[model samples]
Target: MPTATADVLDELVRASALLTEANSVTRLIAAMVEQANDITRSDLAAFYLRTDHSEEVSFKLSYRRGRLDSPKELATNGELVEFLEESEESVVLLERKNSPFNELLLDSNSASGVALPLVTGRSLLGVLIVNSREERFYGRARLQFLDSLARIAAGVLNNAQLYRELQEHARQIEELQRYQENVFSSMTNLLVTTDESGRVHYFNRAAAERFALDEARVGLTLKDIFGKGLTKDVFKTIDTVEQNGQTVLGLEGIYKTDEIDIDYSLNIAPLQGKRGRHEGLTLIFTDQTAESRLKQEMKVVSEERRLIKDMFSSYLSEDIVKLLVENPDLVKPGGGARNATVFFADIAGYTNFSEGKDPASIVKILNEFFEEAEPIIRRHRGYLDKYIGDCIMAVFGVPVDAGEEDTVHAVTCALELQMLVNSPRRTFFRGEAEHLRIQIGMHTGPVVAGNLGGSRRMDFTEIGDTVNVAARLEGVAVAGEIIITENTRQHLGDRFSLEERKPVEVKGKKKPIKIFNVIGIDQQSA
Candidate 1:
């Protein structure tokens, strides 16, 4: 090889290395333009890049007399551009008169130039143009060398463009990931994400604070973060979500330690990736400690209310007892004067009957008698006020008003009590109790009724002239008899049979009060 051919081959080899190693499109274009101007010994060299597979080519970089210049884009419809698009071979413009390529040179007086289309395979990457102030400045030898460089530049430029697009895509993906992390951190509920194998990957701020974890917890297994007790439940729930591909919600468990116990509700959902691929599991924990404790407290309150209602049901009528329990303010210490019926039922000869009897026998007889009588009183809307020695006192129309029927209920209840003790099937003290009988007296009048006692103790009973009259009438009545003052008969409405007895004097009243003995229910009325 001659010296010139050897030098040309050496320059071609260096240009190829530089263009191939160029990392960016700008550097690649600059190197190619510089090498074209040097190899052709031209006064001006410029590169025009194809604009996104369009017919237009834009001015990218230029070299003029060893200096780089940034010029505006070339006219797409110019004569030089038209020739470059139509001719795949090198365009040689030699001092041809009226040739439009002459104007493309940097100096208007330039006489010759050459344009090489930078193409790789069949794709036209761009155009490389060199100009000089000499006719036939770019001969066949230099044109061939520049053409070889153009081919190398086109391939490198394509790679550079691909690299830039990949960088931009990666940046966008990183920004989206940061935005997701911020959203998770702002949540108030605890959130944790893990792989299918239980390896922790992400945990939100709430989860970090609640579990006393830090960034170090990442890559740790569930059992490492939460102790074995809680980890077993968490893994079980995660497995269910992975197997079914469905979210498991509202799973409750206790996170207990020696120092604290927390109640939480858990939700586990499969984390899905592109194309609905199962990636891992996301766990959301809602603190339910306060709500759980409130439920327990309410249960205790409900049980206590039930017990109170049962205890009060023994004395007050069921309706009245429910009212007092629901509104406890009704059981206060104040008393009110209301028209009510008061009744007293006493063992007829209690003092004499118990004189020769054992104390246990006397007590047993009293308890048996009251047990049979109390239910009947309540059944008729009577409040069993209190048991006095061997007597039972009940009142009607006080805590809960029974209107005009208070007297009727009290009278009817008295009749039932008399029949129950005198029945042939009834026995007390192991069949040695036939001698025991009860006398009942009832009076209807205005009486003061309410809870009466000191702050430490209380009894729901009535006191007034009406109660005194009822008690005194019971004291004077004989065995197996139900006596009622005249006030009680007016409210009966012919519901029962009664016999008028002579007026009887009772303590606390100056005049004798007329009384009646209840015989039985009137069969005609029935």
Candidate 2:
């Protein structure tokens, strides 16, 4: 053999050894590129692997060696990939000025090179390019030697791919097995599996603890484990499933321990052998004793609350009645200071409008107005404090913290009330209350809120400066206007469009409070 041919044979032996010992595909591909560069005497070598063979070919892996100025990342030549798809043979370029690979190799510092398509039978693996900075460096003889090397490398890579696929399948199986083990160990239900002869084959952790049995009972029969307590009915259900190969789902039973009698729901599934013969059965036991007792207790509570609601329905608003029923302590004698927002809404000029109306008609109109407005307040998490003649007082952030948006919700609720009164859909708007308008005012601060009255008859309400300020603000409002103190506006942020109004004197305050007239809600929240 000649000098070049002898060198190629030696490199092939080294390459074969590396492939046999290789554990990872990336490390193996790196070895092949390094070997190709050294044996072919090139300035740079790159292995470009085609991963997808769709309408658009994707070169997924590009490994390069022997160039100091090469790009940190790799780029592929679409034309060269197309060229390899058609040609079975290799291509050599003595000058790359007008070559198809000129653009891809522009930053590669190449003058002459050989491109060998690594293939197996008819399958295209990748392209191995060996390029040099010297012109006319690789001739026909070197190209042939590189082709032989390319053929050997491609075969090793194909086997490596098969090995990698096997590893992935093994990893997935291990993961599935681990996941099943974790799920079984974490289950709260008692699970037991037995062979056809009633010999215990498997008992999960819960089953072992519930039955007070240890590892020594693994091979014990059902009669040995449960003794005379393995009832005939339970055994019959298990036998029916094994004999007919049918499954029994959610069968309830009672198990007696020394301390208590536990109610259990069982699910039995038939197990099969290699030839589809009945082998055994799996019993899954779920304890339903606590759940059964809880349902009974809930029924009693529901009956009591129903009676409570019927008695209070005639006296209080629906939300307050429900809240007080569910949490009776909230309406007890005293209360602590709570951060809250108080909203006051009064029907403006209501006395003048009701002058000519009858007493019965006036009462009907007041009920109609409250019916339309109270739900809006409750929807925004405000508690209906009271209906003081023509005014409605609502408190937010009480009974519970309705969040920082309490003031914003109060403003939004006020805006919605005006919309409700002016709405074309209201029958009262076109009838007796036709030109009706409301003035709503809101303020957020600390207040003492709870039931307040003598033992004769207590009332759930708030009493503080916050309540006084909110009521005073309502008195200053004109018809069809929503006025809010500066304190409430500061908490409302930019959620509403506000028009600054003249300052007004409030009761029990030294300085006049500055207020804003809410023109309209913002488009985003509207």
Tens digits of per-residue lDDT for model 1 on 396-416? 886677787888788778888
Which residue ranges in model 1 land beyond 4 Å of their true spot? Answer: 1-3, 20-23, 51-71, 77-89, 97-107, 121-123, 227-235, 250-254, 259-263, 287-526
Give the poorly placed runs of model 2, Cα more than 4 Å off. Answer: 1-7, 53-57, 66-122, 132-148, 178-190, 193-229, 272-280, 294-398, 401-526
lDDT of 1 at 326: 81
lDDT per residue for candidate 2 within 263-348, as digits (tens), equals 88989998888898777888898878766778888887787566446644544457766786797555434676887889899989
Model 1 TM:
0.48
lDDT for 215 in candidate 1 is 92
lDDT of each: 0.78, 0.78
Instruction: List TM-score per model, in order.
Output: 0.48, 0.56
